[model samples]
Target chain A: MNSRLQAWLLALPATFFVVVCLGLPVLSTLATTFGEPAGPFVTYIQFFTSGFRRAVLLRTIEVAVITTAISLVVGFATAWVVARSPGRIKSILIIAAVFPLLTSVVVRSFAWMVILGKNGIINKALLALGILNEPLSMLYTEGSVIVAMVYLFVPLMILTLVGVLEGIPQDLTDAAASLGAPPSAAFRQVVLPMAVPGLIVGAVLVFTGSFTSYATPQLLGGDRQTMMGTFLYQRAMVTFDWVGASTIAAVMVVVTIATVLLMSRLARKLNPVVG
Target chain B: MKTRIHPALIAFSVFTFVFLIGPLIIIIGTAVSDTTFLTFPPQGFSMRWFANIFEVSAFPRTMVTSFTLAVLATTLSLMVGVPAAYALARFRIELPKFLANVFVLPILVPEIVLGFSLLKSVATGVGASIWTSLLIGHALLVLPYCVRVVGASLNSFDFSVEEAAVSLGCPRWKAFFVVVLPNIRAGVIAAFILAFITSINDVSVSIFLTGPGISTLPIQLLAHMEQFFDPTIAAVSVLLMGVTVAVMTVVEWTLGLTFLTK
Candidate 1:
């Protein structure tokens, strides 16, 4: 086959899979926004006008922002530790880092519910200490959702960082230290620049995971906090406003694709291999 | 050449261990609560709720549903994804490298969007069925990870060995089967295990694709969680956690832990 034909032929099966599964609805779901003309745009108008959807979107953004920041901080510490640790401990820590990710998301969310719910472990401990007169309502709030997401996703960030960090030669850091650069200074100047691309993509991953996640918000958040995913689900499945649901799905799909593409471009500039 | 780890990093890693494993500890604790109602630090211990999972027919059926779907979908994804990945990686095609990226982007899209999209397409293309729709949907969900694992392996590969075999007067198919297949084994295994774990644990997609009579483990947990707050959920979670640990251990053993780092 001609190389171009070869390329297309090589890519065709996977492309077909993506086209049928991902590309199709991403295009079709937008039409769901227009609603049946014979019917009304009332669902679209209602969904947009509702302060509830606005609040949910805002909260989702807020949660995503917080998740990115916290996971970055904790993930950095974990990655740094794993990078510098002895081989045996490093392997053990790596296993620990990956365990949460391998488990079912639903299982982990329920694990959080047990940890955070009223009359759950944290509350009982607090009550025993007389710190609180009654068990606190910790579950079904914005906090639980973010915590679960961070716990679920931080390992991903750490993994990427470890890979990038390992690629950077240790000699550079040693040379910096030999020149009297402080340990902290060595990291700030020598390590961070090389690690920037990995960290940025990692940030995007954590951010997007939090933003689009449906189950985490539904199981963990209070009813008052409806994220876009939960919001889309309520519209399509619960309220049966197929169009409104489809509109939100379309917007979400576009946003997700655009964000990743934008990041990949920036990543390519940072590390040419990513392109 | 000396390579020594800093002790400060050890202290920091101790904290990492706590945050990662703490929730599992708390969940298992609550499962044995002696109270008539759920209690945090159980006044006493019992296996009542663990037994309760069996009493509730939903739990057993959900487990069966999750395993069946995971096995079927992972198998379908492997059959499709392996060849596509082979073609992309081994062949020196003139396509833009971005075609490779396009193959893997499905991993990043949220489950909710995927669920709705799959539902719409399946309904439109062929009336949604319990098996076919779920199979295709889960295959889509697992496809990207499989391709990435296999594709990365292919990119850094040595093609000369395969050519060496072809030049030895072996048939073309024999050259590919004998020379190329064995080399990319780790990546293929990684892809399969990832597909299996992901397909098994998925909730967002299953909730949409599943019918009234069909329910998966995550959805099973979701329904139980919605109506009641109890330790049974935790018992089930611990059970699930055991499976998670085992699968990950197997994957790490079979495919080196850093297999994807390449």
Candidate 2:
């Protein structure tokens, strides 16, 4: 076979699978949006105007962004410590990092509900310890949703960062330290720059996973959170508003694709790989 | 190894572990409690809940159904995903690299969306039962993992040997079956475990599509936990946790866990 034909034949199955299974389903979802409830324009108008739609859209984005940012910051510190630790401790810590992800999301999120609940351990302990005069309504707040999400994904951040950090040579840090550079200064100058690729990869994972996370926000947020996930379920299954849910789903896809493209463009601009 | 105690770092790591394992411990504690109500540091140790879990009629059937679904899904994923991996590896496919990204991109896509697509696909087109719909949905979800692992191995293998096998009297099927199969066996087993765990633990899509007649383990957990706060959920959680950790350990040892972590 000609190389062109061979290449095509090889790639065709994967391409076909993606198109039929993933791409078409999503497109069909969009089609449902248009085909149902007086077509696309009306659905778009309804989604934009409806209070539930606006609130859920705004809240989902807010929770996702805050979770990603916080996970990145904390994840950096945790990974840095573990990466530099001794062998046995390092493996132990790595296992701990991956532990959160291994547990079922339902189980993990359910655990958060108990811990963050009003009469649950955290609040009850605070009450007995006199930390708070009253049991705070910490359970179903935006803070709880963000906290649960960040907690759900911090291990992902640490594991990803370790991949980046392990690739960095110790000699550079030693060279900087020998040159009279302080520990912090060496990390900033030598370590941080070299680890940017891994950092970008980790950041992309945390961003995308958090952005699309449903159970964490849904189970934790309850009434107040009513995120796009909850809204999507409500519209599609419960309320049968496929048109509105599809609009929301399309919006999410656009946002995800746009952010990834933006980051790739920014990664080229940063040139952190060389620096 | 001469590092002094980094108190702040130690505390942070401990806190993360606590955050990770705290709920599980609490649920386990609750399940053993003597009190009828759900209470932590449960009133007194009792095996009654485990007994109660068995007494429930739907529990046994649900377990069998869930296990069957996961097995079928994993098997189907290996069948379809492995070849696609070989093709992508052996031949230069003239598609946007984005398609590869799209193919493997469904790791944690919001379940509601998958649920919607699945429901739409089944209800409208395939008109299949929930069992078939679930099998298909899960197979699609797990296919990417199989592709990733198989493709990783195939990419690293010596392709010239395979070409030689084909060039000789050996037929294409024999070349692939005899030559390439042995090379990617580790990946195939690893992918099977990963796919099985993923399908078994599946909840998001199950929640949406599960009719009264069908319920995955995770779906059943959601149902019980919603209706009654008891420690049986914890017992079940422990069982589920065991499977996940077992899979993770095997994946780590066999495939090198770093691939997934990275």
Write model 2 residue lDDT over B74-140, tens digit each, in one string: 8877777787777677764544465456557565344457767878766456687888778877887
Off by over 4 Å in 1: A1-10, A34-49, A265-275, B1-12, B32-37, B40-45, B260-262
Model 1 alpha-carbon miss at residue B206, Å: 1.4
TM-score per candidate, chains pooled: 0.92, 0.92
lDDT of 2 at B171: 86
- DockQ scores for all predicted structures: 0.60, 0.49
Q: lDDT per residue, candidate 2, A132-160, as tens digits?
A: 99988887899998988887888888888
- Score residue B238 of candidate 1 by CA lDDT: 80
Looking at model 2, residue B63 earns an lDDT score of 83
- Score chain B of each candidate by TM-score: 0.88, 0.89
lDDT of 2 at A177: 78
**Candidate 1's interface RMSD, please?**
2.3
